[model samples]
Target: MYLFLVLSLHTLWVAVSIAMQHGHYDMCKTQTKSDEGIVWEYMACQPESRDMTPYLKVKLEPPNSTCGDPPEPFCAMGNPYMCNNECDASTKELAHPPELMFDSEGRNPSTFWQSVTWKNYPAPLQINVTLSWGKTIELTQNIAITFESGRPEKMILEKSLDYGLTWQPYQFYAADCLDAFRMEPKSVKDLTSSTVLDIICTEEYSTGYATHTKTISFEIKDRFAIFAGPRLHNMASLYSQLDTTKNLRDFFTVTDLRIRLLKPATGATFVDERNLERYFYAISDIKIHGRCKCNLHANSCTFTNNRLACDCEHNTTGQDCERCKKNYQGQAWSPGSYLTIPKGTANICVSSMPSNCYCYGHSNRCTYIEVVNTAVCVGCRHNTHGQQCEKCKKGFHRNGSAKLDDVNVCIANICDNELLRCQNGGVCHNNMRCLCPSGYTGILCEKQKCEDTGSCSSKSGQESVSHNLYLITMIIVTRLCTF
Candidate 1:
């Protein structure tokens, strides 16, 4: 089902192939000032001009290595040129390299199928993604990549403090890829037969990862086709379980966060359906988790226990004061949190009021009970509960949520009524299905079960051969007497 959804999207992408031809690095032009602190607009909103030189754009340095013949490295269209005539058809393959998948554009979700491919191994495929935020994100939480499949491969994550000029592996501690096996043990239970692996840095190893660099780099190692398994995972799982050490601002300060994907100088090659061996690596998505980037006004701004400890006003709260505290809600602005506005003396709670308890079909019958610090409506009318007399009670089933202006009343679960209702105080469910009492058995709880003979054993109990033989003999004798 998941594969079908992905393929369907791929087919729809062909119509917009024109916009995807340009590589991201060389695609957008600056419409206004290119200041470091300037707020960056979406690429589509940026002015389009073909005359902008490559040096004028803000782009990461391209990988020193790529596939194809030597003397001049080959890169996808709209990328930096290492030498003259870089993107000339005569010097490069006739087909353009696949575009790398990254940020989402308006109206469309992030394009997942776009990728960078090479007819031959591109040593290591390196992609540098820039990170931008209004207020600095104090914690570097986690990083995860979704690949084409869960295949046996290795990628070294690196970071660069001084932009992409230099890079080093994230070496706070040795990362044990095996830790991921715990989360999805079923996938890699038999490592020999495993095809996908979601590698997560265990809690013990994530301790000071962000202190090393600002740029995140992935160096994927090639695995043989005989043991190919493509894997994908969420980015949050890569962070340290301890929130204190996972703060991003504790490390170096950077204006741009770049992610570089480097394909090895040499790696595995596979024969395509065309019977051609091609060296290609692809990624579907990259996700980063961290606190919101909003400037907040609080009584104090400080880090407490690795969290942004802020004594927000009654109207505001959240990592960056980005949300209104419960009971105070309105449209967001400025600091981004919803507020009651005009000095914050209004009660605009998001939750429904805790008023008189009501159950479905009865407005004044149900009573409220405190359970686990919350009020619960019990003994509701029509076997329902809720502050608004909505929702079915326990042991009842609801097909779906009640529509607006609809009363959500639950019907009784009575066992077969026309036939024998459960005998001996048995419970009824599913209209006629009876839940028999102990010391009794049969469809309607009509038969007395002998405890000594284990006749009341659960249905899953192993039946003795003697019992089966006795039952058969009784049936045979009854049939002979009738004959």
Candidate 2:
């Protein structure tokens, strides 16, 4: 029993290790031993790929696009005489809603969302299935749509990045690519790295009405293979390309996806005017696998309050972790890099405090100067102030006894125009001292000198003096000079 348990645990460990390797950026931070002790080391991270359909809000245009508003009878796609299928919106068993397209499958007879039959033929029966996540997402797998009736003869998959404000065609599908979209037919397998982003019409999925060929897909992995190689064993190459190429990265990112069904499948060359019931769009399932677009700053996305949001890390806060948090803008906001493979650059937002701004420990805050294209240290401590807190401020001197990074490296001035001004007609000399006149004495020349013996005796007789007067003065002077 002990041996069996050990084997089971080993098997579980292997499975977990494989999963971690598959999703390398699943963790945002890790603890490691350093000279300063265990500290959090951050890296580029992203949420795990998951079924994104459940998080989507599906909408069909033309409001009344669904079938069975008034009970309707539909026939099978292969036979026009088989017209026994009755659809009634009022009946629960026969009703088909849009939500059925995303529902779980595996039932004997699949449930589907059927559009109103092409009763108004030659008008072009078109339906738009818009799946909105309301938040940005990055696709990691193929988008597959299964049809219960038949795969549409002409369809177009589109993506929107600005929450549906604009749209662009992702791929086109048609029985005749040149006729439908006016583009040459190109399969994903035929694409190279240079042509990966090119949108082309594919006849692969739209050609047949066979029962087994009911699924139409937008190929994501095939495109990824152009750079990653077949089987995707070298994902680092793909990641490197994606990191450096903004267009490629944007290709996989979307806030919304739209499936435009332009034409229904007819078993033959022409549509039968008599059996219009069999010529409707019916979708059983749509599988979308993706992760939230967190700018590589987060490893988890949560659905809350009926919306999806990334659980941001690396001092980032946004729906997609697109910007830095309020107090962490020491540097300009940037997306993390996937280049230095395994543990990519986090590009974490540094704290606004001067000491955390990479100012060589002299300051915690820094300000990005857009004009100069640089970050200058702000409120530098230890009398330091410069772009990197590497220079001594005016009226201060560099300590000869300490290193540049030392806390006491920038020595305070003995006398300056500000708080350390000279007095009693004394002249300031190079911020190191106040050169006193003959009658005055002290560091800032603030004291009056009793030069004559008679005046000194009278002053001494009038006021009682501490026995350790010299020692006290020296201690005060030392304290004033120290940081």
Candidate 3:
């Protein structure tokens, strides 16, 4: 009996030893350390341990690394090109290598499908960012970025519809591209078997990522569907993880802020010199990445300001509540936190509603939220009613002060309510659609003035959208009382 027991023990020991070996092999040794000993030895090396770091918040550095304080490779005075373009003593146009956000705030120790976003960075003459997550079948949702590219010509957006396999032309014009790539809310496609949405710009050079921006952007929805755009991401899985050293929320850099520059150069080939200068993204600035390893069922974690301190909680991740985490930040079991605005006061404060809420002031506030799905300042007050949240009470006019709260209650009919309407020559159409005669288009016709800016938003032939169709199309037409 003793000999039989000893044999059984030996067999059990062998099985346990083999199990530990296989377990270590299966463990993701990519970022973590490995050791050996007992059956439960491998279990001690959890991926979360390697995920440790002290990076949380950080300065939102400019998109291009050249924006550092001193400004690299200084030259003699009076040299505009050297001072601005990172050029050497002479005028040289070296690509403003972007700043990669590498730190603890970007590493992924636990969870999946996590992503980051930056909002404080204002638009410039030219701007671009590249990112990728998960494997071939991992990239799902779309991303969009709204920028002010200095020049009034248009925006340039380049993307990779495939897994960094091919390329498409860069897109110009934010209005047009945004109008096209604006994703349908909660769209569900066969991401696993068929084509997944790839409308985002992932600027990976190793995968032959030529400047596809040279080509004209493709038709909206179709461009991001299944097979177009610039292919930047080579491997799918490699795109999803984070760097344990940099801030997670700001993983990419903005190389081109060219508001001062003129028209985006139009060339024939896809190269740096031939690179298109302008852009708008399919998923402008707002990118949400998830994990491909786990069954698409959990929230991805994220780091704010270079700090990995924040958990996605079930199925939530990103500077905003983009992709959720497992159980806590991503899982349906938990509601998880909502997507947060990337940086400082983004003209959009969601929670602070009713009182200083801009929605109370602007009619387009809700629409603005929808376009970007972020917070917005309504700028409304007690004496305001119109969309711009600028006006006097029903009975009281501007009362000398046309400001939101700077008006007074009317004692009687101080003046004709009709004559002194929008003083700046804007058509005093009811509800303050505030169209400035003919050459105006803005929240309050604060731009220029004109006679008849065609009518749109109504579809009634002559109906215009307060053209020349740049940003806001708030215009109210009124009948001229000709005698």
- Clash totals in order: 31, 8, 109
Worst lDDT window (10 residues) for model 2?
Answer: 461-470
* Candidate lDDT (C-alpha), each: 0.35, 0.86, 0.29
User: Which stretches in model 3 have alpha-carbon errors above 4 Å?
Assistant: 1-96, 100-130, 137-162, 167-483
Candidate 2 global CA lDDT score: 0.86
On residues 210-252, what C-alpha lDDT tens digit does candidate 1 reach at each position? 3232122221211111122233121121211111232322332
Q: How does model 2 score by TM-score?
A: 0.76
Candidate 2, superposed: residue stretches over 4 Å from native: 1-23, 356-365, 377-483
Worst 10 residues of 3 by lDDT: 110-119
- Model 3 scores a C-alpha lDDT of 0.29
- Give me the runs in candidate 1 sitting further than 4 Å from their true place: 1-60, 63-100, 103-110, 113-135, 138-142, 149-154, 159-256, 264-277, 293-483
Give me candidate 3's TM-score against the actual structure.
0.19
TM-score of 1: 0.25
lDDT tens digits, residue span 378-406, model 3: 44445455544554556445544333443
lDDT of 3 at 136: 19
Candidate order by TM-score, highest to lowest?
2, 1, 3
- TM-scores for all candidates? 0.25, 0.76, 0.19
Is 1 or 3 the stronger prediction by lDDT? Answer: 1
